[model samples]
Target: MPMSSKTMNMLEGLVKDSSFKWLLGKQSSFDEEIEEMGRSPSAGTNWIPELSPVANVVVRRCSKILGVSANDLRDSFKQEASESLKQPSLFARNFLEYCCFRALSLSVGVTGHLADKKFRRLTFDMMVVWEVPAVASQALLSVEEDATVSLEAFSRIAPAVPIIADVIICENLFGMLTSSTGGRLQFSVYDKYLCGLERAIKKMRTQSESSLLSGVRPKKEKILEIDGTVTTQPVLEHVGMSTWPGRLILTDHSLYFEALKVVSYDKPKRYDLSEDLKQIVKPELTGPWGTRLFDKAVSYKSISLTSGDGVPGA
Candidate 1:
């Protein structure tokens, strides 16, 4: 189902609010408001107090989008939260995350919304708020003021692409986030990654359609990760005493290695990943001329192959 503009607008406004006290329907005096601001900068930032009244408006809408009742959704969140020790504030924050994650997961599936700037920004803000979701009244005043998201939050929103189309993986998303933002996820870096992922998915779809039209075997598996450098970080594939530098691509069903032939790449060799093969993939030592001098490669071995192939760390 298409997400309503009103729903998106409401979410956009909700996340943009630095404080959620307004949603509590509480009217405070001028002095109380000033005092609240004078408290720890991180205090009351993570959760909204007295959230039950607003559930009809906020959580209910999200539950509707998910095709679940509001009470059922709340119960499910509580059940999940109960798996770990649950505090009042933590429970509330987790509930909010549950709603936001489910709703965003649905909304992104709508056409042209996955790469929308507002959607990206809203998701990033949700992540930021999720990182510190709890009223920390005694939080240190000297805490860094930098606004950044964390790996935990990134994992929640990043996997949507892979789950939807398998265009990327969690590791690839983390790599992009860390490479650009230096381990701290900023909105700009997050948005750039999403845009790139969208483009890659589109390109892959076009390629699949073209292959089908040309009477070629359509790509049946989704690309999981591609790692290689034409000139710099060469990916080495080792067989016997010989090694060839190439680009490695992993898919849902197999691995493909395209050897670098001077200024171009040779035809890719496919290695199937199947249950019947009894494949064993593990980290092993590899180096020049069959010497096991460096422990920086992954070894792929199966009963069907005489010699296992090793791929350098990606």
Candidate 2:
């Protein structure tokens, strides 16, 4: 049955409620606001907007028109529901899109239903599948017609692609997975400087090879600590503690440090941004020796780099 004029007017008020309006205006896009609900910088962003706190009249009337228990919608399911309800079948996707659009357009008197002719026609022609793009193989995404894949199961096998899955399945049809390896391999702005430092080091090593032929004992070789191709110049160089005062080299891919002295034997400590470099924070400048703080040192310019995740000093 179609909603009465009084009922439609109440629905309009619910959408315009101060709390809901605040949420809608907080972000430039619905996807940004919804996705960052739990993880946004502000502690208050974690607070989910509840339908119950609204005027009781609005809640009762909107709930009755929507044909769902108001109590179910009132709970703090902002994170869980936004995540789980993300990857529903095409039928469910269409149903949700219609509902959201209908609710937003209530002032204009638009109405919809899951059993509508247009929705039913789309559902009939659809193939309910999880199209994951990481493996680039047909087996990765294709879902069998009778197969039922839960959100929990999908979370385990492809934990990295949850955000993408949420966006696509909620909107409709399919989603693509970005290459995690490629994301790591991407270089930063300081790459060119790192590459120059690397070339200079190589040239110095070649010149020193002549000394090895002479009677003079050759210096111990410094080991390469990181794997994968790094193409960048060293924009920042410092001495930091990795068991000793190690030579710290900051480049596009990693923060690398190693002791040049006999104690460490040129074995370097490497912290690759690809592995777990979440955030860099709380930098401090300090001294080379105990209680003797320097404004500038030969290494690091007296600046100490600190990582939020407790990566060794660099």
**TM-scores of all models?**
0.47, 0.20
- lDDT minimum window of 10 residues, candidate 1: 208-217
Which parts of model 1 are misplaced by more than 4 Å? 1-47, 50-87, 137-146, 160-172, 209-220, 223-250, 255-270, 273-314
Q: How far in Å is the alpha carbon of 187 misplaced in model 1?
A: 1.3
lDDT per residue for candidate 1 within 53-76, as digits (tens), equals 222234444655688765567667
Q: Clashes in model 1: which pairs?
A: none
Question: Which candidate's lDDT is highest?
Answer: 1
Q: Give candidate 1's error at residue 36 in angstroms.
A: 19
Clashing residue pairs in all predictions, respectively, total 0, 10
Candidate 1 positional error at 210, Å: 7.2
| C-alpha lDDT of all candidate models, in order | 0.56, 0.31
